[model samples]
Target: MADAEALTPRVFIARHGETEWAKNGRHTGKTDIELTPYGIKQVHTSAKELVGAKKLLDPARLAHVFVSPRIRAQQTFHLLFEGANSVPDESVTVTEDIAEWDYGDYEGLKTAEIHALRKSRGLDAERPWSIWKDGSEGGESPEQIAERLDRLIAQIRDIQRPAMKGEKAADVVVVAHGHILRVFAKRWLNCPVDLPVDMVLPPGGIGILSYKNNNVNEPAIQIGIALPVTD
Candidate 1:
């Protein structure tokens, strides 16, 4: 039997860097946007701290990479893996399943703005609107998002399981937007989709999901950030 440490596969999720809409608290979905100058710098720094030899994500250990179709996400992925000499271009796949949540009518609107609009429409008068619960009009619901993420998760495990038993690396990386990745994290841990998640992944932040005790049945989110060590 493989040791507990050897067979555990990991998923690394990196949220795309800041955009104009993201900076202003707008719901950025479907619409393509480029990373701001600061956003580019942020991801470059994250790449330095998180990827490479002896880093949280060693390039040699990366088995596959799933990137969102959004430009911001695609740009972030390139920046993060720019220096990863071991990861080949062919190993990456652009998947819509990992794309940002479709904000639909809520696109370009802030939370407060959406709430005001909802109030005007006599929707959720007693409580603020929650995308996890109420979903966006003409957009995907919590159930839909959950279903998509679940399917992706299963695919990830299928790729990793066999590799875990061999000498090849089994780590998978995903570059996506905030809400979808947060919801993905929740679903990764088998938590209820509608439950409020206090967890936050700032722009260019990285989160890790791995199995506990090398058992796929016991998945967990490894909390904490990887920061550069300074003397």
Candidate 2:
């Protein structure tokens, strides 16, 4: 069972810890910020339980660690592997591909604020605005998001392909923002970028992605995994 499991690859997606803008329901794209004190503490707690030998994100099995090019996500990744020794420094890459969705016009504004602004501009009269569907004005469109994510997906698959043959490390970790990570999950399953992605990932939350039946071509989301609850 251990060897069989080793033959399969998994991608662990972790949303960055909360920032002030995040707690206040701001769009927070391209505005780099650090995690709050409470956010840092919570991520540390989660790391203690979720990362280690035989844990969900064992450093021993990690092939790569992809982090968003944002301060909050960088902090989260640092805290996540604070005392870990097996993770090689060379294996980690900071990438813009996993950064938060570029909410150009909506940056630092809440959903309601965005709606009101759009309405004031004579937009969204017949329908409410949705970032997933309409994307942000003056920022990345759905097609742009899909293009970057597809490039990332291809890179990850190339790294994981060797694992299918038991040649190298198989597991990978992605530390990024809420919106982009959600899109990453959806895109991993080859879902259309413009469709509604009905999913919620809280601050410092963790989710898993793996291949169906251990086949690299069949990607699927792992919906359930046991982890220690932080009080």
Candidate 3:
């Protein structure tokens, strides 16, 4: 068994790099879109800076990776792991559970456009539209998203708990979209979905979640942004 301190497990959430719609603030859910040339470059840079020896996420410690099925997410995952050593192809799983929120009727629309549409439809005139509260119509509700995320969080804990006992390396990486990954971070801390998330996840950004006190009961999201490494 490895030392318990050395075996503390972590979940690293990496948001995919920019797409045309993402750059323009459009709601990109369930849409398969490729990363822009700049987005590809951004993720490659992120891979070099954040993943490796003595970096934010050591590749050797990574046990598994979950990625969204979206093309942008897949592309970002590919670029992010390009330089990683000994990461097996089977260890990476593309799962819909981590995919972006199904924007439904709001899909492809920017925030301002969605707001205007809601106003024209006489909905939520008194309060600004919040995906956290109301969710996207013809799509998932907050409760639905919460249920799935809660399940995934539990599964992550199950995978990490044994590692905390020093059985093996248990760091897991999730590559996905902005809103979903942000929500995952919030839920990792057991925060309510109705609460506003002040954390900002830029394109190709990486956020860390791990146990405090080396116990599964003390889950917390690490503060401070992780910047890309320059070569």
Candidate 4:
């Protein structure tokens, strides 16, 4: 029998580079924004070290890629594969299912601002606001986010299952926003979206997901793909 590790496939979740709103710590849902100049530099550096043959995300081995409809995410995806000879257009799917969390009335507000707005509106008076639990006012609930992400996750698993048996290309990539990608990681492991995800995906950051022991039934976060960069 072949090694279990060799047969298992991987899913790479990449957060888009920083935008002005992101750098300002504002809620930027439904606001199509471009990556900042520094943000472009961040992704260019990331692509240089991460995407290539024998690297963490070899485009040649990439089976498919799901990208957010947001401009920042689209820019990040293009930058990640800028000169890579692999990754044809047919393998990419631009989707809203992976877009940033809808902030609605709280859009463009920071966490403290959101709390103040909620308090003034007589909401969350008994407890502090938690987007994971309370969700944004006039926006999507945890249930709605889970519904869309679940559908996408199901599609990804269907594609990955065959690859786990060595029947096809194995690597997959998702380019999206920070909050949504964190929720995605939780959903990939069957965790409830209403609870705190306890994970952070910084701008231009990358994370991996895969099945444990080569068993597609057991999805897990891959923790040791690369060495941590130190300044």
Q: Best candidate per TM-score, number?
A: 4
Error of 4 at 207 (Å): 0.4
TM-score of each: 0.92, 0.93, 0.91, 0.94
lDDT of 4 at 10: 86
For model 1, state the Cα shift of residue 122 in Å: 1.2
Off by over 4 Å in 1: 1-3, 84-86, 163-167, 225-231
Question: lDDT score, residue 173, model 4?
Answer: 95
Tell me the tens digit of each residue's lDDT in model 4 across 106-205.
Answer: 9999999999898998888678988888888889898999999999999898889877866778778999999899899999999998655478888998
Model 3's alpha-carbon lDDT is 0.84
Model 1's TM-score against the true structure: 0.92
Estimate the lDDT of model 1: 0.86
lDDT (0-100) at residue 117 of candidate 2? Answer: 91
Give the higher-lDDT candidate: 2 or 4.
Answer: 4
Which candidate would rank higher by TM-score, 2 or 4? 4
Clashes of 2: 0
lDDT of each: 0.86, 0.86, 0.84, 0.87
The digit string of per-residue lDDT tens for model 2 on 4-103 reads 5545788999998889999999899999899999899878878987888777678888889999988999999999987753467899999988888999
lDDT, residue 154, candidate 4: 90
Residue 80, model 3: lDDT of: 81
Tens digits of per-residue lDDT for model 3, 141-220: 88888888898888888888877755687899999999898788888888987776576889988888887778999997
